[model samples]
Target chain A: MSPGSVGTVATQHLDLPGSLPLDCGRSLRRVRVAYETYGTLSPARDNVILVCHALSGDAHAAGLSPDPPPEGTRDGFAAAASPKGIGWWDGMIGPGKAFDTDRFFVVSTNLLGGCRGTTGPSSTDPDTGRPYGSAFPVITVADMVRCERAFLAELRIDRLAAVAGGSLGGMQALEWATSYPDQVNNIVVIASTHALQPQGVAWNAIARESIMRDPAWQGGDYYGTGRAPDAGMGVARMVGHITYLSAPSLAEKFGRRLQSGGDLRYTLHEPEFEVESYLRHQASSFVRRFDANTYLHLSRALTYFQLDLPAAAETIMARTLLIAFSSDWLYPPSASEEIFDALRKSGKEAEFHLIDAPYGHDCFLLEEARQTPIVRDFLTEGRA
Target chain B: MSPGSVGTVATQHLDLPGSLPLDCGRSLRRVRVAYETYGTLSPARDNVILVCHALSGDAHAAGLSPDPPPEGTRDGFAAAASPKGIGWWDGMIGPGKAFDTDRFFVVSTNLLGGCRGTTGPSSTDPDTGRPYGSAFPVITVADMVRCERAFLAELRIDRLAAVAGGSLGGMQALEWATSYPDQVNNIVVIASTHALQPQGVAWNAIARESIMRDPAWQGGDYYGTGRAPDAGMGVARMVGHITYLSAPSLAEKFGRRLQSGGDLRYTLHEPEFEVESYLRHQASSFVRRFDANTYLHLSRALTYFQLDLPAAAETIMARTLLIAFSSDWLYPPSASEEIFDALRKSGKEAEFHLIDAPYGHDCFLLEEARQTPIVRDFLTEGRA
Candidate 1:
């Protein structure tokens, strides 16, 4: 076993009884949540930390697969996972890491509308016994928090030591602290905005349009049609990927640089620029795992979410830490500053840090070296 | 006729003898140019100003409909034109406007790949007597300049008083001064870049993808099919429209303010934001007038174009005036500065002006109050 490897981890599903009422006045008769836990819960249950995943993230937060796959066996996320089977944010959640599994219990779950083993559009409808598809009720970030809170209740963890995430995950964390003020003591929001900007919403709208406009989308009921709108979904991914990157980053990586053996001449259907090739690859790889309907539902949730920090500041009990990247135009530092200003105006304790990371919004995921220390310092000391 | 209107504007087609050679080693025998001339050509022929139009623009510069519509009478561009037969640059090319058609004869032509009565993909193939369609030879900005040069020779015009345009038109202006240094005396390039940015190219690539991926496109031969890929073309325009406006402009103009009677809840295929509605309008109106293949060709030309000022500096005889908008992210001031710097390094006379216009790249066409004075002052004087 490699050093620092999370030896074994297991993801468990919790099927909660009773209807999960949503903000849209709709309710699911039964809700299923797939989650994973690391470290032992303290006797007092005071060391439990909840980690929220981003838009397309799953429950597996840290640690290796419980059973090593046999030679040549590859399937699901297991194949995508590292040799350690560690989850997203594994760098900050393991033993001696920021979240410090050895010192604090860490829990992660697939978001409510996510396709990864969660109760989403892909989940079987209790009444129809078929995938919900376009029939799936829309969910908000607050609803996702409520769902996650239910999972926490099932585990008998009354209060969270800390709630942390980035981007959409950060939105979820903010919602958790805002909705259940007493349940979370600390909050870390990175590269996120209190409310999605109109420009951001514009991009999301176009992405959704790309998918829904596809004939193969079949009005989001392509599950039984034997064909999916992979091309549309791919284009959406490509567009989204461009937003995730800064111009400077793209220029530095591929400034008019052509693909291998590529020329500067006009050729239809040919990717002359390296960036085009890169975006094409990103699009093709994304359609393999993501669900189109789930994307639609989650993207709608993002735009629909209205996070008024001034209103939430009065009720927010968590000591907040907001981190934003300098080059993240999608969710610029001004967004975090807005939340921080509101917290200050409300007489709440908060800290805001703008990292000079030119990697754009995805910096939270890619610049782990810079993000880990900042996150660790915030998580450990309550506020930086 | 309305006073100050460019009355009796006629679009004249000229067939130049001999073949027009292209950069790609292909030549079109007997090239046709659709152009509009305002004012009488001086006896010396030195009072002529060749006006270039941007992508999707046509041989229309200024003056509203020469004759007022009889209440509901509608015809071609005359229907779309303002009451005075005003052209796209109505603000800048009027009797007392910046270009001052009363003093200088102004000529504007539909670009090489344009569908507006010019020889393009929609034009008949002289050899086959059918629409060129996808078989149209790809054209570059330099090729566009060469075609315009042919038009000038056909008019027996030996020297131009000035050549001016904005955006893609600006690219053509630069190409003109570079290719035919002795033919043009002054050049005005506004809201343009010496070289296209990868990010901008990325957006163009997606827009083209949106059109090409449409099943209705039928490999660019959808003409006369009664069902062109309007949806895809519209989407492309929507994407392009977003790039043409600044985020702050969108925020100030539309914000997250939903369309009238719009809900905050999830609804499919609905434009919730006013900005989305605006984009839809822009896209729909564009698909009505613009051809899909022309968009592909022009967008490809933009990406493929590489303007090396050093190479053309020695031969560039036209004293140049470069203008950039303050909020034009698509082609910011830095791009203009690059050309200015190159001209300075090459010991050429040039002036660069950064205008404080927050309307983004389209500011050149929209913010003429600010642009008019700068352009007028430049054209009136020799050089800054």
Candidate 2:
């Protein structure tokens, strides 16, 4: 693989052959998976690595767009995929980076319930010929994994060199290992949990409530309306952003520092603290890009995550590496400990590491210096 | 002193004679303070103990209503002062409890910017004959203490036996000792800080934002409309409630427990977890009783709290007792440490205790067994 081959990337769609059986005992048909890929498939097709995204992530995982992104990228992409096409994991996936495109084929797909190019709430319904919106079926972590597995089938990849992600992406990594233990040889999970803690669940619930309570939400049927539930979505994003950064990080960055041009006194209106101004900016920008119904679906899926599959424990074969951040209150050290303990109990080889970082849940995304070497070593040294 | 004397509690109002100057350099005239007293004042007024209420607290500190509370109790009171007039500190302010009404005359007053029968945003402006609303002057911890000082002067009490409170009330107690060093003999502050931390300020800012964003807020002048910004206030209360309780406590009480009627799987429209239901109830009840404008004012005051008073180091003559809960992230142990270190550096006799409790910031309010003895011992054994 060369840098030139990875530089020009576009989202590609595949119509999955069969209906996906959901965790809710329902089935989804006419499933279209949108994905992006880099590197090349080895002759044996064993160099494939699947990259799953967390909540609000998309298929645009890497590459710089010399040209504009694929046509459907903007219509539903929840994350900030640059028009220049820089991916979320752009730092970790070049010729010599962690994934090391020279030796590994990388596949990144938007989650099933995402608003991106993949079929989700913002996608048109085959039966009604309209966006799914409120009519979209609720999706679980298992359902998302099933769609990705189908995508793997479409690519004719029999086994994976590794499956990796952070946060909700990490959740999918765990699910991939458990759902099909024989297919994955290595799994890297970062700053994530098997199931949502009560506090995490509460935050998700409140975020959803903030959206639902918006008059413009219109019971998740705001797609046809000119106005989306941007206020509710903005509040949700603000709340989520707070959890993404550590308290110490906020204190160090903003402190009680008043916003520039604002008086250091109390007021009934106006942003006072720098943190408030920052949060406002984060919320406003998020509402303009993300789909509210997709947010609702994905957030709900997070609450339903359960890694206690008895059958998976018995058959699990993946060599696992679990990483937790010191300040990630959303997915704390204890959450990773639970997964580590469960894997060891099941007679699997699992390694756990806690990184000391102030970025909180976002440490996995930002601390590339610390992460790249560890990930490269794990991916390279473990395989036959 | 007798239990019978304490049982016949009465709420008293005093119209302050002079214009009350604010920390913001504004003067508030026609100031009226509503307070409730238990037990009789000593002959020398030396046994008078002043109790300062927290953000949502009122003059009704402890008492059972024979029939029901006064008419205005519900209209303005910030906290859950039952119609039967049960005090906020019911467990620790009785005949033989911490404050021991039998031994000390106890006085609790609503803060200046509070809605609870105090001249606040809900109170009428003498000039316009309408609610002050946004016109109500931004207040500080010092202003609240000043109003309490006036109450003390009206009662002809030269010195206090003690001044005590928790949370925002704790801020007031610190203010009482520092602002008028000669008037307060002892100060007991619990689950509070010398100043608000950046995270605390952020939370308060978000809560206030939640309320201010409500369309019904109407620039803080909804008095004639007969409609309050309940949705915004409810969201604010929900956010506040999350900070008040610890993650461990929430996990222990409602760990992934689903609401009884909800299904086990993901749903976009319903409250799934028990914690979500619980928070919703908390928010709904809070908005019904709390005044939105007052929430804004009080929350802002919390951000402005500062114990860096130049005179406090030299003039704070009160014997101090500072209690911090280990799980209180809002006002953590470090917060109390700041206050304790300040008091000790000032050459004051101060005792500090960090109680290990899972109740978070509300530990001071809920852990009566732990706090009652510490407070009683400090008040009874410290005076020379």
Candidate 3:
């Protein structure tokens, strides 16, 4: 179906209690979760598939609702505005695509520490009745998976057909399989690793620092002021954009061509090259949609993701597929190798494929040619 | 020579007019050249070896004077500090080193449009009596070589020995032989190219744009205001530093390691990885010593460099040795192949060697084991 064809489903707020004790020796109470669903659930609810998002992703995943509200009708907290966009992953979730909306019902949710309809730094602190800001409890990947389980319970889904995602979403998929092996039958982890390598965490650290240093951040409590840390967020996006592309991809695309006009401006303010303008546009676009605090929170959660698999072989019940990109420096093929090795050692039916693409870590989002058949065969043929 | 062996030697500055008109359609006038000499000039003065610096190098090419002044004492209207106390190329030049001090009278100068003791954007505008700033004329690589010729004239030295350098310095060395064939006898173009391809230019453009976009740049007129564009310059340096190193180097040095003591802050302000901190330090050090405008000027000059040899393949006069590093993405071995092919096609005696080093573009600066013998043999043995 085309955009805006699906009907909107009202979601109930979920309160999930924190799992781990906080650093302050206290446990967080009443964690709230927000989510959206597509297609119809079967009588067994075993046909449910969960889609997780990356660092800046929100809950509105795939299939636009019919009679959607006009653009900007609900301010920043409402659904994303573009007609073609309910979520960033809409392309993979529709009829006969990867997620196959026709057969299996799909669910996507905003993470615990997210800005969109979830309990985050932007959410009100029940004790203070104001935004949590810096006071929002720091969280881990297990905590996020706990909230996802809560969302699943709210929908009365006892078991999921599969859980799949890329990047941070991929991390969540792995977390689901490991934390609740019986809950998930099929797991597809794309371009993600068991833990954040120092390099990955380093990049996120810089992005976070860029936001926190912005005067507009106001210690993460700038929601009412309307002066978000746009500049800092822009810088973060620029850095993130660089990491998303391989060196060869950058060389092929922008390779130092001057601006449209002939001569160099010989000044600093003017655009000297086209790539600079492209990066500037990317930075600007990111700042408009993403909350700086949420960016920080989600990035940290992704970094903290570590799966505690069964020590003995044959313990993991879920059949696994690990996909990586050859040029994805962020989560290279080596990471996939680690997962594949772990699954093999555990006597689980596992497969690994490294798509040869020059797009770097972003290949998962764009390499449809390489991904389609591999994912389709693995999901359809493997036991679930 | 421990940095203070050189005694008194007369120095001079000469002006060379640009051959082509700038973007403003104004031809540069009296393009001032600053240079220094070490060791006594032979009776014939044919023993002079011209030394060139990389993108941000200056005229202090050799030993410091016996009586050195305080830092910034001789600011000399350039964006970088005076090279009066220590020379950047001191490591390879001296008593019995590669370019032996007693045998060859070395001549090193600040390049045209350079900030260190040379006529660049920070130089006084003849009409306005203020720094040229954004009004400074755009310069070409050929123009820079011509200006070097003027400096040679002032020194009463007609080159007979050799010209050598790494990176941009190597580019100048190549230009010297092509632009003034009769004025040179031997040439060593190390880790450089005739023209910067799109990949190299892409990195340069990003770095240049970063400096220009910094608010402190003030349209390239931040001189005397003590408000240089440190942010932009820092970004520029960060980009350049990446090019100077290979992926393997980064992986080995900073791979995913957290900062010394702290855990991930879950905010955007702290460096999560050691590599990020390393990059920050590199950027900061560069901005402290180099000018933003000079970076733009030199990068543009590199982009425009082309060897103009008349006659299809038989007109190359100067004996040339082309050296490149396998891992140097900035000036890849492919570019050096083009240079070697052109020279060989002309039936010229040319030698090319691709040194295998993993340090990337900066390999030329650090690979002493590979460099010493090659450079020493090429310079000392031969056709004179």
**Fraction of reference contacts reproduced per prediction?**
0.38, 0.57, 0.23
What are the per-residue Cα lDDT tens digits for candidate 3 across A105-137? 888888878877877888888778888887876
Whole-model lDDT for model 2 versus the true structure?
0.80
Q: How would you encode candidate 1's per-residue C-alpha lDDT over B229-286 as one tens digit per residue?
A: 7777877777777778777777777778888565664576677777667666666667
Candidate 2: tens digits of C-alpha lDDT, residues A236-327? 87778887778888888777777865456556577777777877777776776579998889998887887764445566689998999999
lDDT of 3: 0.70
RMSD (Å) per prediction? 3.9, 3.9, 5.7
What's the TM for chain B in candidate 2? 0.92
Per residue, candidate 1 scores C-alpha lDDT tens digits across A282-304 of: 77667876889988889888887
Model 2 lDDT at residue B148: 80
TM-scores of the models, in the given order?
A: 0.93, 0.92, 0.83
Query: Chain A TM-score, candidate 3?
Result: 0.88
Worst 10 residues of 2 chain A by lDDT: A69-78
Best by DockQ: 2
Candidate 3 chain B minimal-lDDT segment of 10 residues? B70-79
C-alpha RMSD between model 2 and the true structure: 3.9
User: Could you tell me the lDDT of residue B326 within candidate 1?
Assistant: 95
Of 1 and 3, which scores higher on DockQ?
A: 1
